[model samples]
Target: MSPFLPLATVIGCGVVYHVAQKASGAVSPWPVLTIAYGAAFAVALFMLGLGWWGRGDAVRWPAARDCVASLALGLAAFGIEAGFFFVYRSGWPLSSAQVITNLSVTAVLAVTGIMVFGEHLTGARAVGLALAAGGATLIARG
Candidate 1:
């Protein structure tokens, strides 16, 4: 599959996710998130099972390292979900909130990619990062 397909899918889902989140702003955050996560868990489990069946393979338990990484990702995802719910409920507009959050995350990930992953940081990328930060700030202020 093309990488762009997955990227576009994630972007599309993110758009829908924020819209639904804004619509549900009046509901209790925890209960709403609980139902959301429950559905996600179900879908994830079903996908796992389907993959195993299609591959005619037994369910292999994840390695310790993989398990640890996945756990960390899950924790981070929970934080993101809960944080955004509260942020939106607290009167942050969806447009600005999404822009700021996504831009901030991109900036942090760019630095992490360069520092921790030894990815090259070109001059162009540096300028882009700075501009992204400036844009995010402007969006937040306006």
Candidate 2:
């Protein structure tokens, strides 16, 4: 699978996500998340029913460790969803919120990937990091 397609999916969904988040600024975040998660669960269940579960392992139930990882991911996703709601409520414009968050996440994950996962910080990645920092600074100043 081309990375660009998945990246584009995130970009497209992210645009809709932020718009919906901003639109729901008047509502409590938890209830909103609950409904959103419910909808997501339904969609996932439907997909699973369609036999499109995982990459060869989706048919089998996940192992305990995999479940644990999924739990951790859920917590992090909740934080992200709720955090954005609060950020939006606190007056962050839609234009900058996603950009800033993505940049920050990319930087942190880059460091974590290198330090924890022993991924190489190749010259291209280094340049990308530098460029991201520069872009962030410019966005923040605007």
Clashing pairs in 1: none
**What is the Cα-based lDDT of residue 5 in candidate 2?**
81
Task: Write down the TM-score for model 2.
Answer: 0.88
TM-score of each: 0.89, 0.88
Q: Write the per-residue lDDT of candidate 2 for residues 50-110, one digit (tens) a residue.
A: 6653444447688999999999999999999999999999988887777888988898998
Best by lDDT: 1
Clashes per candidate, residues 3 or more apart or on different chains = 0, 0
Residue 37, model 2: Cα distance from true site in angstroms: 0.9
Local error of candidate 2 at 112, Å? 1.0
lDDT of 1 by residue, 1-142 (tens): 5779779989999999999888884567788878989999998899788775356567778999999999999999889888888888899998899999888888889889989999998999999989988999989999
List candidate 2 stretches off by more than 4 Å.
1-4, 53-58
Candidate 2 lDDT score relative to the true structure: 0.86
